[model samples]
Target: MDDGRENLDREQTIDRLEEFQKASVRAIEAHGFELKGERNGVAVFTDKETAKRSRDTFRFIAWDKVSEVADDLIRGATQHEEYTGVVNSSKRTAEYYVRVHRSLGMIQLRVLERQDWEANERTCGHDFTPNPPISSISALKPSGEKRTVGFHVNSRQEKTCIELSLASPTAEFLTNPWSFVSDHPLDGGPRDYSLKVIFDQSMDEAKVAESSLELASRTIFELDIRNGISLIFAPRERVRVSFDAPREVPRIRFPRVKVPREVAALFSFASETLDNPPYVFLSYYQVLEHFLPMAHRRDALKVLRRELRDPFFDENKDVTLIKLMNSIERTKQVSEEDQLKVLLRDFVRVDKITEFFKSADMKHFSNKGPISGVPEVVMHLKSDPLPTQAAKRIYALRNRIVHAKDDPKYDSIPVLLPRSTEANSLKPDVALARLLATEVLINSQD
Candidate 1:
């Protein structure tokens, strides 16, 4: 009967402990703290709203343990009047006091220690400048405390470092394990400090890291160029080429070579042909066709007729009649005169050809040199004998490549010169056509 009574008391004690645990959990929930998980046999709780905001875990002791401790103190309070007073004070403290600290994603920065009294005098506390100074605002409420985040820039030891101070019950520094280290400025100027990721609740950790690195790389590239520095990345080494002044880099002054708006659309197509195999030849011819001034066969015939009607031609009527008949027959065979030879013969002059060569050379080679192996191709075109011959030969080459099927002449001409030869040739005709086309496009812009 006594054993049965002892078992009954044990069962009652277990039931009361369970009741106390449940009540403690409820009280914690009412106090705006959530039971996160158990750690080291201790029930862990955190502020759910703070966790969401900072992306850092703010941990506290679970209320179940708090209640158990409270129960033990109250049970012992019946021993003495002083004990009773202590129990009441402890109850009040347990009910109100809560402490929180950063568990992960950030850490507390350690204060630098001084070796001697002189070192202490020289050292200052947190040598940092908060741009748009951080407000000393507290989020502490009657139930719980909330801390506001802060950012600052420090220029200590000639280096600019960005520091993030996280405010919890205990302050801590936020850090990432996947950060990269680069060369520091020798003079202690602003050093590159990269944040590989920003705390975002929506993205997973890996994605956040990847996005942050990509953004950092892009920003670095832009900064390097803007500051007249060339950053070259190689295996195991990073090369940075810094210029003394922005003027040293001419490319910045002129970002792009101006081209005519009318023919600007064609330049992309022409550029794309350099990559495409089948359309390569066609691209050159198309550009050339567009570059030339278009003329109708009927227009040529009308001009011929007007010349023949002149008084000087009337004296030579028989010669004029024969010439007119031949011209009429030729005009009947052709509807348009877009052919390079015909266009050059009718419209393009020697000076104009030289100008085209100079413009094309300036753009393509980035230097004023002879295009292809043609010596003074520009000057020769401007001078006496070779001008017309060179033009006709270039046109003839174009015709063989475009019109002829399986022709050897197409393989004979070297387009890229020393880079290409008779045995392994790039079509010279295509090269010349592209060059002239580029010139036309440039001229049309002005």
Candidate 2:
């Protein structure tokens, strides 16, 4: 008796499922969607008016795999909310559509059609050339691939449209933006391809306007990252930086930097400078200038006078006067050594310099033997406890390069400075400068 009762309950559940399917079909048809019969358990539907007007039926399919679509549509009709569904062609492509009930009397329809490389030539029909032609865009012509995104509005018919076409002799279209989509294959595909949004004629004008504005804003934001921004270098690739504003520059926060405001300003300036043209040298020099203390004649003279009065200088008046004048001249020169001294004054000990260099992961000073080709002044810093020796060597190298000296000597060793043409060879010095600047900026706040 228990076995017979279980069979009866199973039969009743199957009967109820079939009845629900039939009712869903009736409700779909009543809402002006034509039931185009079922194939392999998938039921297809087309809008009656769209089929009549274009003879191009907008096809949507419902199956047991997506039974939630039917349930959601039914719930939307009852609760007055939007319903959306997608029918995928492949793992990476699909056709998506949305139905929104705008009011008691009107409904909105939207469709997005996506095509992959396999269907590229066959999907559009008749040679599939973009309107106005892709040949007219010079940049795209040489790229061997073409992508076009166009927006149109038909006021007479009350429709807003977006069209995207990507074509290539090979399969480069599936690279950039498409690669990002392909990474997460289970999430459908890129949402922007060949999107077409439309609202019914009966929709309120104000509501329509608001929706249009929202769509425009979203499209612009996505395109800005897709086409405009490119991260060419890693975040840790540091550069020496200085600001035009002395102390009142607006600070911005950046990751890892303790004094973010100054660093942020420096990065902003560097970005702006790089965006203009190819003024890399000037831009880097400007950054280096910011860490340097401004040289005032009176302050420099006081320091020089103090030094001369010490046992370090001769007591002769002529020698003293000559030294004072020379100090003034050096201050006017804006030498890189002066900048380095100012930056390293507080942290000149060998241990401190070594610790900072290790933390920054600097490799410029690792080669210590005679065969390393480093100048004597730089080599002496290896055994010395003061950073002054390293600063002097850097300044000497800077002078030789800036003045274009054929053969400059540092502590009597023949040194070769990097020429303008040998920009790639200057990586070591550039890295050192960046590290030094970073140290200076961090200490400035304290």
Candidate 3:
């Protein structure tokens, strides 16, 4: 029971992983799936085709820490040749493939594949029948805007949607085109072959796009488990250009003032992607919260000053005096939402925010609308300053993200599902959070 990982690289770990692979092969063989052999670290079983149709077989690097398992490689494996192995329970379609990394408790696969199951039915993920079974994707009820989704199933079990992923793609789209398909390779990695269907610029809701992408990629990867093709979406050029953050300007111009330790740490946390946008956004929100108390106090004092300076002020009047006293008392119970609005106005620049949102992509925030669709963050489309729009949108998204479904005490917000296409569209939101966090940290220096 040495699961503490002190035994990670011990010879016993390798022996256990080998035993597990042997047992999986035996169990899977019951349904006509046979372990042909092991090649490139993937235990090949009877799929539609043999391991390769020549060298065209998808390839991948074996994860060093074997125990982290094949699924863990699905995260960072965006390279051209890189793929993760999968095991399936169905006898009709594909079968067992092991990209075994003998780690800790994470290795068990009671149901096998990660694909969504219906009525706990572990059906084959591939299109084995002439008309593949209707998917939960239909429940999404996408726009009636002439998008006909095709469900193809051939007796040969070919990778139709997959093999064609990079067949023909746009070099770059025309300016303001209604829709176009583009294949973006993971930055310095392999081709992601992302076939994104889009709507008009104003309403890019995600359910349709996500469902399609997941189905297509999953199909290709499953068909070629021995080849090891991975589906990590974020490009290195996007999520993380480099592990190092740029400091050319900062090196030449030292800060006259210093940021508090907590604020600085949060700023650093927000700068890097901890796997996804939500995690990074949470870190940025933390930096913003560090100043809430001080900003809230400053806002309260401003109200008191404006009220006291009125020419009609009367010290003898009890009604007027009590009203002013009540204003002071209300500050003690002011919501963090109100304080966030104050923080934006007090520290963030209107001109800067307006400039940032003026870009074609940034235009999302210039008008009132929700990007992710979960929290329904609507920016202000009024004559008020840009910070008003920023405050409204940022606060709603922040609150929605912070509110977790689990843990009764922290159950103030609904859970933002990680796999939703809405979550995938968060790159723009991530950019916004990064910009806001940087501004607040620099402004709050002492």
Query: Highest TM-score, which number?
Result: 3
TM-score of 2: 0.30
lDDT of 1 by residue, 1-446 (tens): 12111122323333544676756655555554555444333344445457445332433333344575334334331111110111112211100011112241122111101001123322334443322212222212243333323233323442222232221111010111111111111122221122211222344433432343344345336434653322221111111211134345655465366655545666456556453322454565565566454434435657686777767676356887776777767655652233455544444445756654554443332223323333233344344433354455455444434454455764554443111122023334345555556554544443
Clashes (N, CA, C under 3 Å) per candidate: 3, 6, 13
* Cα TM-score of candidate 3: 0.46
lDDT of each: 0.37, 0.40, 0.45
RMSD of each: 28.3, 21.6, 19.0
Per-model TM-score, in order, reads 0.28, 0.30, 0.46
Cα misplacement distance, residue 148 of candidate 1 (Å)? 60
In candidate 1 the C-alpha lDDT for residue 287 amounts to 59
Cα distance off (Å), candidate 3, residue 57: 9.4
- Sorted on lDDT, highest at the top, how do the candidates line up? 3, 2, 1
Candidate 3: tens digits of C-alpha lDDT, residues 1-446: 22122212323333545665544445444433343343334333332243553321211112232223232222221112111112111111111112222341122111122233233111224432222112322333354222222222322232122221211111111001111011112112222122222112232233323333445456546634733333333221223312235545454666665788777787787656555677777788888888888888788999898778977767789977987899899988888877888898888876666656764265454334335422222334566566766776778777666666667764554566453344545666766666777777777764
